[model samples]
Target: MSGNWTEQRIPDQRGRIAIVTGGNTGLGFETARMLAGHGATVVLAVRDVEKGRQAAARITGNTAVQLLDLTSLDSIRTAAADLRAAYPRIDLLINNAGVMYTPKLTTADGFELQFGTNHLGHFALTGLLLESLLPVPGSRVVTVSSTAHRINAAIHFDDLLWQRSYSRSGAYGQSKLANLMFTYELQRRLAYHGSTIAVAAHPGVSNTELARNLPGWMRMIVTGLAPLITQKAAIGALPTLRAATDPSILGGEFYGPDGWGEMRGYPKLVTSSAASHDQKIQQQLWAVSEELTGVTFPVK
Candidate 1:
């Protein structure tokens, strides 16, 4: 997927249906735009209805927006159900919505805001929409993660709600790590059941609202430094786009930048930390997710 990738080689996406969380802005917007530009019918599953519509209008490709507040389980189920009722199949589902660096806050569901919106909500949505996803054999689900995950080690199961100590970066790391774990677990399950859908992807560095939760001055500094150090949002979207449409992709493979320590570059197949690849932890997290969500995946 390195130098070999060219816009010409990309497949014709006309008539394909795709769903992108947070598709109104940032990397998600770029991803949705690229997919839609290639002719896929994109559903912009955004948190804000008005903003989503505005964003959809701004995009040159075919797209529509629907309400999707990832902070609430009910919201996820309702939106997913509506999508299922409207679309016969989803060719791609990009879990690109996220928050970073914020004072500890809880969602409408009483879970940590970032974890709830970033991990659990997508978890529930994916599970509930198994009907729409599975029938499309080569359909892919790309969960966006950050390089910050490499330094994160604590899943903090005992304090999952962050009832105890709290650190913004730590919590963000855990949520992003969960994205990776969930991807691997889904891949394992699909393989075990011989399902053809492939799941993979992560974003390394890009300027986006996801960092809105960051400390004010820190975000300013990050924005200030991003020009020199950060990849543009379009480049940031490449990994996810590749994972979604690349015919050569394999399940459980992560993609990111190839530049300095993988912080920025065109999307390519990148490896994560060994801990991120641990199957034992993956299984444990999967168990906890099912127990916590009370929604069993339809895949056997």
Candidate 2:
């Protein structure tokens, strides 16, 4: 497809079911709104029920709210169970929620906060919900990664939890990189079945709450440059929307902004870091994720 893909190009989604994590605000909210407006029954899977409901109300079409705390495994499982019971089949699962530049901290599962919520949480959620997707044709799993993955990122296998030392950017990069690795690995695993596909996307630099934890100096710089460098959540969501709905999009493909530095513009096919395409590393990350989350994909 050309670099002009927009939400207007999104195909009709009348009976499709889509679940978007962190759909209450920012990119996720815009994504859900667009999809719901186009006829899909959208579910806002978020940490806050009231916010999700408010978000749902603002959407024009069919929408629902589901409480999902990505940092908690118990909550993930419960949400998955509830969703399974509510919808026997799903057409789209968009893993769009994430944290950025967070202070040193851990999740309820005792993992680095960024890696835990951004990668592992989505990892486990997808695994548990795979069965519902596997039986449906044209089903898709779209993971939202970031350009940050290209910034001094490594899996840190020796100390996956960053037990040794932690740099906020490094940890955030690791998680984003994991998001890409997970997409590639999942697509490879799903290839034989030919029923579902995994694709990835990045919002570029968008004005969102994800950066609330950035250091003071960095935050000020971002704020000052926001108008020229950053796009709104609607624009930032195009790549993900394209990845989720575009019929031409293939598994393992990535989409992002089409502007300079990929910081803003329309959605277009994009490339990721060479390190992110390392098959060996991808497999290793997959194994480690399965081990960490104790949730295995049904494909393999």
Candidate 3:
């Protein structure tokens, strides 16, 4: 509700347990660091064990590492099982891992790289861990989307994998859009159970390693204008951290930067594109995601 909400406003997270995907670097690392610093038992769920350990070593609080390669469903399943075994209750699940603007590529499961890793991977992980969250009052699932969701984005049901052809920007937009849709749909499902909630947030234009896959020309352009347009990853992680820890946050809400064009500033409650709020598409994508990942939520 304040115009200047910062990480310091995060209530003491002394007893909460949080799982942050891709916590080894960039926005994920910053998110994990802040949550851990605030007293939450943070798990850095990364694809690289060594990097994860290094990340955990950097944080000075209750933190641990877990291997989680979003590109592989097997890895997701194993990581979820291990987490369930270790923690009886999960207070937060931050779907902070994702790819962007990559060349046409598929995950190990044959889905488009961006869609699979960004949307489906998180979709499956959340479902697998839903039980651990259900019993925990005040639990939350914070999914990281992007402002890119408004750029030529649509859920292509006819070819969800972009099998025929693909545009790097378009595919990335689709994946980010799916992240918001999944959050809204999941929140609707969670409403019936009345314990946990789903929310979404975006970093705006952050200077993070997520841009490594951009094409040469675009990369050059971005690099040239990076100083004026991009915010540091730490600042960018605020929206997500706020969504995860803000006690006043509600289900299905989206958060992002408060600056011009939402390119950079303090975190605030923001509105996504109209299409992203479409309940019909959100529900349809939920069904397709379940069928594709073979991971179904326990929510009725």
Which candidate gets the maximum lDDT versus the true structure? 2
Q: How well does each candidate superpose onto the true structure, as a TM-score?
A: 0.95, 0.99, 0.98
Off by over 4 Å in 1: 1-9
- lDDT of all predictions, in order shown? 0.81, 0.95, 0.94
lDDT of 2 by residue, 1-300 (tens): 444888889999999999999999999999999999899999999999999998899999999999999999999999999999999999999999999999999999999999999999999999999999999999999999999998776788998988899989999999999999999999999999866999999999999999899999999999999999999999999999999998888999999999999999999999999999999999999999999999998887
The per-residue C-alpha lDDT of model 2 at residue 291 equals: 96
Candidate 2, which segments miss by more than 4 Å at Cα? 1-3
Q: Poorest 10 consecutive residues of model 2 by lDDT? A: 1-10
Shift of residue 12 alpha carbon in model 2, Å: 0.3
List CA RMSD, all candidates.
Answer: 1.7, 0.9, 0.9
lDDT of 3 by residue, 175-273 (tens): 999999999999999999967999999999999999999889999999999999999999999999999988889999999999999999999999999
Clashes of 1: 1
Q: What are the per-model numbers of colliding residue pairs?
A: 1, 0, 0
**Residue pairs that clash (backbone atoms under 3 angstroms), model 2:** none
lDDT of 1 by residue, 15-121 (tens): 88899999999988988888888999999998899999988987888898889999887788789889999897887888888888778898887889878877888
Local distance difference test, candidate 1: 0.81
